[model samples]
Target: MKNTIFIALILLAGILTSCGSVKYFGIETFTPAEITFPETVETVVIVNNAVPQPKKPGYKYTIMGVEQDTTHMVADSALYDACKALGEAIADQPFFKDVRLYNDAVRQDEFFFQDTKLTPDQVETICDESGAEAIISLDRLLFNMEKDVFPFGEVMAGTIKVQATAVLRAYMPGRNNSMATIYLTDSLFWSEGASNLRTLDSYLPKPEVALRETAAYLTSGAYRNFVPHWEQAQRWYYTNSGTRWKQASAFAAKEKWEEALTIWQSIYEAQTNKKSKAEAAANIAVGYEMVGKFNEALDWAKKSLALFKEQTSDEKDSNVALLTLYEQVITSRIQANNKLNMQFGKE
Candidate 1:
């Protein structure tokens, strides 16, 4: 199924209010999988066991029934770069005591996917050599590449496309078992203009260049499977309360979260005016989110709604319009959070 389009669901007016309010909330846009390891697994090593893509140039190929034997066609480096990225990402986190990227690939003879996986014995030997408790083996990295020439204004452009699929297996030698094995598929598309279709190869880059660039994006992205990460997310707040908004905005700009929260909390609790109180409560919600206290953020959101309900006293009050819009915004957040929980197992 096509991914659900969030544009229609997003509260555009809330997007408007956030800019006006000088407030932002930390929304969990990405929920990566949790990492697992044996108790003895203090360090992990990554190795490439996949069959290497042919690197030799001067290979003849029939493209669109046109034959060409090209030179300077180097090897594909996607798997190697991905292996390095995974190790670097793990080392960047405090979660791992140590991480190593093995430069020497585990040479294999098989050219097919199923035949290229590392055996359990190979995994043990790699762990012993690298002095790692576990091993992340790149079993296979296969790419189906295609190039097409399409009309681009007065000229023509060649699109280089690739679908990369691979299997990565995590083995814990200490436990004598596999921790996690995942198959991933990623695709990339790039365009280069050409004056004519026949000369497209001359205009386009070497296949290895497109392969490396595509691999960089696709492989580094999949590395998130082993760790939790944060992604930028957009959220909205109320700024109609004017002075309190400015007061809170100043503190936020200074990065003094506690001081701003203090001011907003005071307005939320002690303000005599209902409108001011509700807006303050909403700001308080944003404050909680900014500090990564999502449960409190949710609680304050409920409190804001309750105040709105109290002010309306019925569904027909003039304040009901604002309340309805706010309700839609909150409901959208709840839906998004529910999706996050389901995907990441209730973080």
Candidate 2:
């Protein structure tokens, strides 16, 4: 089934107005993945091929600016956590028909080397055994842990940071080369300030917990390249003081876009001031966005931007900035829509 293509408007509380009368709402936008796979590969298998952190010496971890012999920092479960996260993320998408997780480590002996590749025969065997069209191999997962503590006057502040790097590859049965190779690095940080050192220490996550969390974060982003995802974005509409503007805002608050759009059209037609007309046009563009009319939204947003520039004679005006931002948002959505169509096999 085609994913529902409609903007979801959410009203923000407390601080509603910006630029005197411009109020903003939240809208959900779909962003396309960085890579688009062929539609023929519908089922995917996620495998862990990375070796776990060894218990032997030579790997040092720095915490609080001191090297510590810590047993909890050994990341025995890092590969498992990363592979599980990738599988879960892929399963969340409706684009793939099935997702399988291979629990065993395919390359347990490979720890220092990074240039390893799965042979074509191995890819075929894995796909055949898992009943999947392609394989997503978690090739390598490595981490570096660091912590810093400082004293400021009477307070103690500490920060714990974990750096993770992961390499992943995609392979089909007959392909000699990987369909995609994703090499990503990510960092997770936790900072807390307390009256005492003990309190600050209690606020940070344990070493074991931090290891798993960092592993998950490293691989979770790889799923974005395989599927389209929704991102929350802010969009503003003008509600300057007026009965008609207030009425339209009320209707828009209820998600009645057509009703609000009707009033905004009337206001644009009758308003003499360029600023007022620009406000109405901007609101109309948001209404069109709510109804999934992106082309129309882009058109009205351009008109509103032009009007704002004409009214202020300066591009630095707040209203001009607002319209400029909205124009960029609409343009991005239009581009994402095109990529989404290709990913969904509509193109």
Q: Which is the leading candidate under lDDT? A: 2
Candidate closest to the true structure, highest TM-score: 2
lDDT per model, in order? 0.64, 0.79
> In candidate 2, how many Å is residue 339 off?
1.5
Over 4 Å off, model 2: 1-19, 56-73, 111-115, 147-160, 189-209
* TM-score of candidate 1 versus the correct structure, residues matched by position: 0.70
TM-score of decoy 2: 0.81
Q: What root-mean-square deviation over C-alphas does model 1 reach? A: 6.3
- What does the lDDT come to for candidate 2? 0.79
lDDT tens digits, residue span 1-347, model 1: 00122332134434445456334343455443445453456788888877666654223334444554553334447778768776777677665578888778786565634535566787878888899887877777766666656677887777667677777778775445567777878888777776776677686766777666655566566556665455454554555546766787778666676788998887677788887787788778767766766677778877876787887667754334444544454555565555555444554
lDDT of 2 by residue, 195-297 (tens): 8878887987777688899999888868887778877666667887799999999999889999999999999999999989988998999999999999999
Q: Alpha carbon lDDT of residue 106, candidate 1?
A: 85
